[model samples]
Target chain A: MAKGIISWIDRRFPLTAIIKHELTEYPTPRNLSYWWNFGFLAGFVLVLQILTGIFLAMHYKPDASMAFDSLQTIMRDVNYGWLLRYLHSTGASAFFIVIYVHMARTLYYGSYRAPRELLWWTGQVLLLSIMASAFMGYLLPWGQMSYWGAGVITNLFGATPFIGEAVVLWLRGDFAVGDATLTRFFALHYLFPFLVAGMVVIHLVSLHTVKSSNPSGINLEDKDNIPFHPYYTSKDGFGLGVYLIIFCWFVFFAPNTFIEAVNNNPANPLVTPPHIVPEWYFLPFYAILRSIPDLLGGVVAMVMSLLLFAVLPFADRSTIPGGARYRPIYRVTFFLFIADIFVLGYLGAQAPTGYVVPMGQVATFLYFATFFILPIVSKREDKWLRARLPQELLAQFDRTNALAKGQNKGDAP
Target chain B: MSDSKSMDKPLDCPERRNFLEKATAVVGGVGVAGASWPFINSMNPSADVLENAISEVDLKVIEVGQSQTVSWEGKPVFVVHRTPAQIAAMQASKGGPDPQEDTARTQQPEWLVVVGLCTHLGCVPTRDNEGWLCPCHGSRYDNSGRILHGPAPANLPVPPYKIVSSETIIIGVA
Candidate 1:
């Protein structure tokens, strides 16, 4: 009887074994810091976006006449529809926050170094796709911001050299950003999250192929690593719970906090808002686009900003520091890159005039320079440090390095 | 208590068993009560309720030489009230081969009422001097709800409508 009962209980509760396998069997590098958690957090945010977006789409109207009213209906009528809309809107912002942090984590820890370069490149592409998805979603409501934002962004394609106007018209489906544009944008916006999800799976698969790098910058060499279960699982769960609480707060108490009130008005083609600004996340790139006096140059600058991420693996010279005990210059340059991004974001929000253009150009130059100068700086610094190291310190380093090497060979699968 | 305990030794006392059962019942009762709110909230509208609900629209607000819009079943309905002059211009245009064989085949004459949604992916058609324009996919409709130069595969739908009063119309009713 007792055996039967145990078997029944086991059949009813299979989650335990699954959890154990995920958490205990999976080996995670011991050096992983809080930075590693953002990838998981980004994944969590992606799920949230999909859930909220699916709900919102149920009550949303894609047509021009009813689009505004449909939004109003969702806010006013459908059960918990307001909650769904707010969650989706705010979720977009939160998604960007986590992705930016994830990218920063990569930069700081040199997670973009070799073998993981493809993973980082895929992540960069995913980021660009996310931005595009969000931009298209912003236009679905047919509100003032949706109208003008779509118009301005579609017009950006017109900045291309010879066939710019034709490309812009093709994108618009008409001479302007109207019904055709909104319909296509809605379709693409709805479709992109799934693509991003696919990319994320690939990113993780690639990530797992190479052992995760830790803050110590050390690669795994032995079974000193802990299973991902109770250790990291509990840690990530706690992180998720805290994140959800903040997300819920935004959804419940401050649904419209991120939405501009000016966007509440219907889209007017003839009337241009005094200042046209892209969403906050796009501001840095937008600033770069505007900094160039010529249209072609502005387009090039904007594209370059995104393309730089793909080239990062080869940009910096520092040998993948097996540990963080070295490479101070790389760290400083990483911070400078962050500062440049923030400065560019600020400049993007300002009107294009006087010092804004010049400042943006300087920032844009520095942004590219960080990538171009990294390898040279890393090589020079490594050479200097090797020559200047004391004999005693060098001897100790050699002993520890050999020990680590021996451990690595022993631990290999 | 001694008598009850002695009785419980053989078969559980009725009062004690009843009390324990009631306690379990109360706990389950409270759980059901706690869960009912969100459960009911998620239930879909009944078929009967949906059947009786407003699925059509009235297009009386449309004026001659102007277009009027109404919402039916959460979609836009455009009623173009064309003047005699506008109707004549539509008849004269021959720039492209006509998608519709007979312009006179349409039931509505001076006032054409169509589901304002574009044939290509359903963006609400906006009225300009030329005709109805879909801002979503660039599909355009002529004054008589016929597909003009656009990717629209079909003309705008005309909801079944009737004039209830000089200024009022009822749509989606036979």
Candidate 2:
């Protein structure tokens, strides 16, 4: 009966063929390290987020009048409601952490380079969809942070000339972030996860088309390729186990780790918090946003920070795809870039005043300077690295050739 | 293999083919748009949410020269009990920025009520020593909610409201 159903379904759809092609028989480079596990972990967290979100929605009230009360009810009244809410909320943070690491991994490996630009772009699209979804979802609680955070963000659009007021009104659906904003945000919040899921499909499809770029940033032949089923399936299963343990550790122990204390109170438009900070994931960009003094210029600077990633493929003019591990200078700059972002994030959490302003401005400047200067720096750095790095490539090449000759078959060399 | 049906020209007549193509496109476009209407409509506040939108507040609790912020239809409605001197200052003002009369913003001379949000953006303006100051921007309002200074192009809007009793007021359903 199982065989008959499988055959029937296989005849109608390419179900088995697709599974075999993309999952079981798919060839993945054997040299993928633990860093590659983040992609699967991100995918895992996305699923978890959607599942928890769906359950939370079943009990959630999107109206500004009841949104905070609804969240309270979910926590206090519903069956394991607190668990689901915490899971979803924590899952959002975890998803960002995983995705950021995944992006960093790709950057370090030069995975955004040639023939994989679409894959990188699709990943960016996925990132944007999730970011939008997260932003909209943040408003559903209708807490002080939800109201004021959204107020600050939407007002940023008011910097636009001519139709700025019209745009702000249209986005809010009224004069302010009140009933209309909450209701619309809820609807869009529900809609965007499905959009993210769809984008994930496109992302994965594009990823499989070009395959993956390994740490060495070099293409590996069939000899270096391993089947997905026994090799990666088992590997990913173990990675997921470790990921879940860490994830559930947060979910069970410190569920409110990510939720702000100000959010516990219902939204009071009159009483602004001393500091209106967004979720930690958005802090870096928020820092950049506040770094500029001009309203329109600040908005532009913040937007450019996000859009800078999109142009990385063209700007970072280097043939070395995964050469960061070998290139000492790029390696140091990459870590420094990471450090700069962390500093910006720290600045974002603080009020934009006094010495924090200057520090944030410098950090923000360095953040963009990393991207703008990477191509020029990498051009010089690549030559220096390559002159010293010929032996590493040769060794990798010899290993691939030996694997092709069946000298290193079915073993971890 | 050589049937007349197969031999017949795919676009038998260009006019009919064009009409058919255009008609299909239009029908498909209308169908898609029609399907999207409900999703768009659902985004607005439901009748149930709007049912309890109106809010009533007791004015007895508010003293002279004091302001109270109340939620009406899930937005902050600022109710200020203006002192005689404060009211005079507002009325005596040689208008600043986008000017509006104090009487227009209030139904009673002493009782001033307007949405607390800044006219420039939706941020709630903080009650200041004078009247109100928008923390997000420098937009200021007098005791009567008139835009006094800054980038605000308009005054704080007064929501539909009415005095229901000697000490009670209802906002939103006026």
Candidate 3:
């Protein structure tokens, strides 16, 4: 009887066919490393965030007067509320960790090359949407940092050339951050995650269209490919197990690691905190904004810093398939770029005084310089690497080079 | 017979079709914008918020050289009773970074009023012996709230306020 019912449903819908094609029998490169697990991990964190957030939102208030006390009620009064809140908070940090690692793996493997540009672009949009969600979410707690951070960030709109003050007033729903701003942000904060989920669907569709890029960066034959079900599902399950252990440790033991201490105090518009700092994730961009002298210029610089990531597909002109693996110069620059980001983040957290000022300016310069330098060096390095290729490898190198340029899509056995 | 056949024929008018297509797009665009207008305008400061914009502070209690903070439009307004020496110094020194006369920053020499938030990133500046110093980025302001040095491009903003009686000063009137 169950078999007959399944067949009836299968006739109406392609349910079984879709399950076989996408889940059970989907093909993936056999050589994929543990780095490939981050995409799965990011999806896991998103669901964790949504589930925890839904439960937390049930007991929390979004008003300026009640928000802080509501959170206190959740911590002290509600059963298991603290666990849900901590899990949600830590899940945000975990989400970024997973995404950054996923992006780094992509960069390292040259996964954002031709034929996958749309996939990379979709991922960029997802990053921006996630950032918007995080920014709005931070304000829901109605803490001192939340208040001032909203004030400062909304003031960024005041840098607009003509209608600056009006834009700022509209954004805050008043002359300063207050009740109206809080309610609207709370609504948007809840809304953005679903938008992010939709974007993730688009991202996956783009991904499945081009398929996964392996560490070697070469499009392999079907013989080298493995079904995603038994092979990758098991590997991903193991990775998720390891990630959860670390995530839960932070959630239970050190929940406040990602939360600012000043946020414990209720938001007071009259008093801005002595030393105001944004959440750790925003520090690098905040540092970039601070480094510039002009308000409008700083806002522009900070925005460009993010939008520039989209240019990576074009900036990297190297015909080589495997990124950094076969190229020495690209590898060195990649590490330098990471170090520069660390410096910027560190400076962003400190008072903008003494050595921090000059250091920040220098680091900000280096950040942009890294992008500008890539295109020039990549073309030269490709030529240099080609000249050094052995006779036997030259014909094979030429074939792969054309493939990397996206001349063909046939990855058949 | 030819006239009857011509009457039955369909007219292939490219210009008319093109105009209709453009007209439909424009009307649809206007409808979408009209539908979005309310949602966009909903974010602006509401009637209730605008109603409470005006705040009154009794200036009778504040002593010379002391400053009082009053909330207006949800922002801190610094009301300082300037000392004789402080007024003299500001009058003599040319206001910097953003140059304005000490007379311009104040309505009366003794009563100096400016918004407490930093002109740069909006952090509230703390009062000091010389002037108010912004703690976040180290932007210094003189007694008249003129920008002295640091990343701040302008002086502390003067809000629209009025002194109604000798003792009563109302903020946010303008």
Candidate 4:
């Protein structure tokens, strides 16, 4: 009976053979730190967003006239609709935070090296797609903020060189971001997250194929690894629980903490707010885009900043197998890269001015220099190491040491 | 012996069974509690009756060539006290405002009683020279609550109304 019950439970649960193999056959480097857990955390947040967003969309009205009223209805009427709305809104912010951390983790660990370059590139594209989805979602409420926000953003196309006017007109679907634009954005915003989910699955599949890199910068050639089951499974669960606690706190108490309530008022096209900033996640690129005086140049520079990640693997030439133990130069460049981003974010928030022009130029220069500087520094470090070891001397020393150790051990016997 | 020892334990442990029972009871309790609110709210004496209540308006408040609005069934109902001259002018401009010129149009003349909502998107139509104008969706309705232009599909709804006193009107469910 006991045997029968055990078999029954195993059959029902059916821990997939793949999972069992991952647990028993494959061994992860034991030295992995908390940073390694972020990818899984990001995946978890993606699920949270998709689930909550789906429910919110059920009661949301796509039409301009009813959109605002529908949101109000959800807030005031539906059972626990307030909770669902808050969860979705707060989940968006939380999603950005986790992805940023995950990207930073990859940067610090040098996880973007050759084999994982495609993974990093895919992730960058995913990030860009997520930003688009979020920006579109912000305009769905048809509130004052949503209206003016869409107007200002869609008008950016008006900055294009020859066809700027035509581009802007096409984007608006009417003369401006009106009912048509709102309906289209609602459709795209609902569709984009699912695409992001598909990209994430590919990211994980790629990640598993190439075993995780650890802090020690060593590869596990033998059976030194353990299955990913009970060990990593428990670890990921604990991390998820802690993240959920923080997520729930924001959902319940401060859903609008990151959003402007002015957005709740009806959108007035005639009135423009003093400062129009994109959501926090896009602030850095938005800053870069604004840095250049020329509209086309600024747009190009902004696109390049995001696309620059694709070139990172070629720029950083360290053959060091593990992720964490980066050379000193790489470490300093990483911090500089972070500082450049912060400076750009600040510049984005400020109006383009005499001081901002120079600051933006300097920040942009440093941003590109970090990528170009990596290959040179990595090459120099490699040569320095090679010069320090002479092959014949190393071989002679090894032979002498072996003979001496053997003789000493034999004498003792 | 190892297998026999394991089998000796019961299929349902008392501790596990008790925990399951408690969990189910807690879930059932919450379900019951949640189900009671709507039931209790529905039972209130005024809940359903108040929604259909009629409103009384003082027609004297409305001057000649002007419109006065009163609440009926949570909606605005417009009552216009027209002068004999104004009624004659409206009749002269008959086909100009009322397109169909049906019985509904013929019925509305000196005292216009129509729902004060835009037939297009349900915004409360603000009174203007051309009768009522919806701020949202830009639908226009003439003084007789006839659809003039824009996307409004039909004319404004006319509430069931009766003259209560010389200067008073009562609007209720027809």
Candidate 5:
């Protein structure tokens, strides 16, 4: 019987216990919003990307000479290869969309606050890993954009103080972006997703340790919590159904939405396209890089923009509960930051020209300003809002704070 | 309880034990790094890539006022047989972004050789009447391959070359 097998494994390993504890009976906030669905959706996309990527790799050649041709062959000759490729490409974009929403949800809900810092950091690491994987995968097709984009990004290392040139050369495995670079990128692209999957496990572990933060932004009591199996499993399943409909539409109908037209042509280093743009996901950071006049300064600024996420827990030193749930000013600030990011992404797609330069400068300033503004606003808002809070809510807040303070003694709130 | 308490106590040579532990960890760390070096260094330019370092160009075939594109280590090398007017125009103006004299950018004023890729983002600049214009970004380069104006932080790089004979020039060898 299934029970006999499970018990046999459970005696040696914590298999049944793990499933029961971590999946079926795990405590989760009952008031979790649709935004909570994105984490599950991100995990789903990760698996989708891995599966589609494995299938595509079977027919794809990594050599610079044959890379483009191999892709064509996959499209023309291999059965369901186009579907696999499209799904993988579409899944890459979907993964980013899901992660961004998940992160936005985190920021809005103050899920990155104390006791969940490791979870946020793990998510950040996952983002970096996925970005690296996507960058490497972009070069696999050996298209003009792939070649030039890789050249441009790899050249960013050339902005380093001393060992810049050497690092660039080492990265390319040649004087220029060539066969060695393509092969190596292919190898790493295949590698990074597995590493990401491993990190995803860590991310989950961190998440479960602190438990999920709800939109209400309060640590709900045991009575307010619900078991994961029937509640969240069903909810996540419904979210997955919705996500798949959108994903499959892109994969089948608008497969090339994420892919570039210039990427169709084989990589010719001798000719640069009229305009070389990065994939849509990288546009905001690309805009930030272009905003700075100096190469080294731009590279540093771009890198800092990403690293700024890691410091959010420390930066917003507000004792405010319910992140943006009650804070009107903070909500507006959050929306403005999101809009600024959109503007930056749009600007990044355009050529750096007359008005674009000035506009980009303004947007870049706003992008960085949001982070600097957050702490001051959060602290002041906390003071302003605390006076107006109901006595019961204030007492609940105090109790939660006490629990957070006492967490070092290995007690869960 | 007594036996367990005694077991928890320090050994006779605790310092030596600690030293052994530290030494083993250090050795293991070094071993891991040593094992990783080959895989890490394998990504560096290999022998076959290094072998194709030099590219020989037949300068005799290229006519005056004409720019010939030749492959050098898989990068486009622009060999422009600069006209007298072109050389004069380049020598007269100071390059923007990176201020360099025309003479510094070329081995000979009449025979200008530089990597064809744009200094901004490695896009090949198309030849123009006045200079080269990078289509990707709008980086302009003078006839001598010095950056005129635009986002390119530096001039089109001048690859190392030796003028072996009147007919041939060897690129990638000084």
Candidate 6:
């Protein structure tokens, strides 16, 4: 009887086949590490954000006058509103954490090379779209930080020529940040997640198109592959367990760790805060913005800093397909680049006066130089590597068969 | 490489076919534009949005030299009952930066009204003895809200206001 019903449904839709193809029977590389599970963790965070955000939106009032009070009401009055709000808020910070790790893993593994270029670009767009959604969502509370933060960001557009003033007025819907801005931001906040969800779909679609890149950075044969159902699905389940432990720690114990104390105060336009910094995730880009004294130039530099990731596939001229894993020189440069961003991010939170400005400029210079000069350095290094160890490259490119790799003399280790 | 199909219709030249294709595209474009009109129009200010679109301020209780701020459409509207000296000083001043007479800025000689934002970067300016001083970049506006000095390129904008009675004025409506 169950078989008959299953066949009836299967005739209409290839449910069993789809499950086998996409989930239960999907082939994945055998040597994937703990880092690979972050893709699933990011997806989990997205779902968490959407779920908590939907509930919070049901109670959120977008008026600047009432938004602050509404947040209090949600905390003090609504049933489980505090839980939903914290989940959504902390989920935002958690979202960035997972995504940053995911992107860094992509860079470290050279997943953006050649065939996965489109996949990587889609991810870059997804990152940008998610960043925009998070930025807009931050204003829903109508806190002092939210008000001035939104103002400074919108004011950045005033650097554009000709229709700058008109565009600014149109965005704010008033001469200054007020109810209209709040309402519009709320509407966009409600709208952007769905847009991001669409981008996520595209991102996943592009990812599935090329299949996943592995840490080994080599194409695995059927023998080196495992069905995703019993293997990766179990690994992913375990990863989710660890993620939830960390997530629940924040949700239960340290809910307000990522939130600022000043954000408790209502938005007041008459008084500008002592320091106007964006959320921690945006600090590096914010540093880039303040690094240049010229307004338009600053805007351009900040934009280029983000969009430079798109040029990564073309920028890499290395023959080492094993990514930074095998390339020692590139690996050192990669770590230095990460350190530079951390320094820039720290400088961004500080007042942009005195030594901070010059230091940020130096960091920013190094950040850009990382992408532009990597290809040149890799090309030169490839020559020396070819001279000393030409056999390594040949062995890496032409592995006879995965099952027979144990017998391969070059890979004796 | 030429096909025999072209020989059958000598009048159907490349230009004629191109014109037909272009004309069809233009018509389709117009149809799409027409279809999009309602969605575009719906985004304009609806009735609910227009609720806080105008604000009425009571002017009777405000005495001379006293200023009061009221929120209209989420912007601070400054209503100052000008002192005789300030009004006289404003009228005597021809043009410092923004080329506008005092009469043009005020509905009544005793009452001064303007949006309380700096023209330079949209910071709210603080009122002073002479006029208003922008705390951000130090742009100054005269009693008539004319740009007096600093980085401001234009005068503090006078919002469109309707004085229905001597005791009350409505802002944000022509």
Which candidate achieves the best DockQ against the true structure?
3
Q: Is candidate 2 or candidate 4 better by DockQ?
A: 2
Return the TM-score for candidate 6, rounded to 2 decimals.
0.80
By lDDT, the candidates rank as 3, 5, 2, 6, 1, 4
lDDT of 4 by residue, A260-329 (tens): 8677777654343444566777878877776665556767787888888888777766544433354665
Q: How do the residues A227-270 of candidate 2 rate in per-residue lDDT, one tens digit apiece?
A: 88889888889999998899899999988899999888898766
Extract clashing residue pairs from model 3: none
Model 6 error, position A122 (Å): 0.8
In terms of TM-score, how similar is model 4 to the real structure? 0.63
User: Could you tell me every candidate's TM-score relative to the true structure?
Assistant: 0.65, 0.79, 0.97, 0.63, 0.95, 0.80
lDDT of each residue in B1-174, candidate 5, tens digit only: 998878777665789899999999999999999999998899899999998789999998899999999998888999999999988888898878788889888777889999998877678899987889987668888887888788888888899999998899999999
Model 6 agreement with the true structure over A1-413: per-residue lDDT tens digits: 99999889999999889888887878888889999999899988988898988898888888877899999999999999999999999999999999999989998888887677788898888889889889888988988888878887887788789988767766777667777778988888888888888988888877665678888777677799888889998999999999999989999999999898889988987655555678999999989887786667878999999999998887877766757887788788789988998999999888755698789899999999998898898888767666777786557654522322343233566
| Candidate 3 deviant stretches above 4 angstroms | A404-413, B1-10
Best by lDDT: 3
Scored by TM against the true chain B, the candidates give 0.60, 0.90, 0.92, 0.63, 0.90, 0.81
Give the alpha-carbon lDDT of every model: 0.73, 0.83, 0.90, 0.72, 0.89, 0.82
**C-alpha lDDT (0 to 100) for residue B47 of candidate 2:** 70
lDDT of 1 by residue, A1-413 (tens): 98787668779986556555455777788767677788889999999898888888888988777888999999899998888888888998899988899888887887776556778888888998899899999999888777877776776687667887677656766545666667778888889999999988888777666657677655565676888877888888888888889988988988787787878888865444555667888999988876675556777889998998887777655443532246666767778889999999999888665688689889888987887887798788767766877877666655645554464456664
Complex DockQ, candidate 4: 0.01
lDDT of 2 by residue, B76-101 (tens): 88999889998888878745777777
Error of 2 at A99 (Å): 0.8
Superposition error at B153 for model 2 (Å): 10
Pairs with steric clashes in candidate 2: none
DockQ of each: 0.01, 0.22, 0.85, 0.01, 0.71, 0.18
RMSD to the true structure for each prediction, in A, is 17.6, 6.4, 2.2, 19.4, 2.6, 6.5
Model 1 chain A poorest ten-residue lDDT run? A316-325
How far does residue B46 in candidate 4 sit from its true spot (Å)?
48
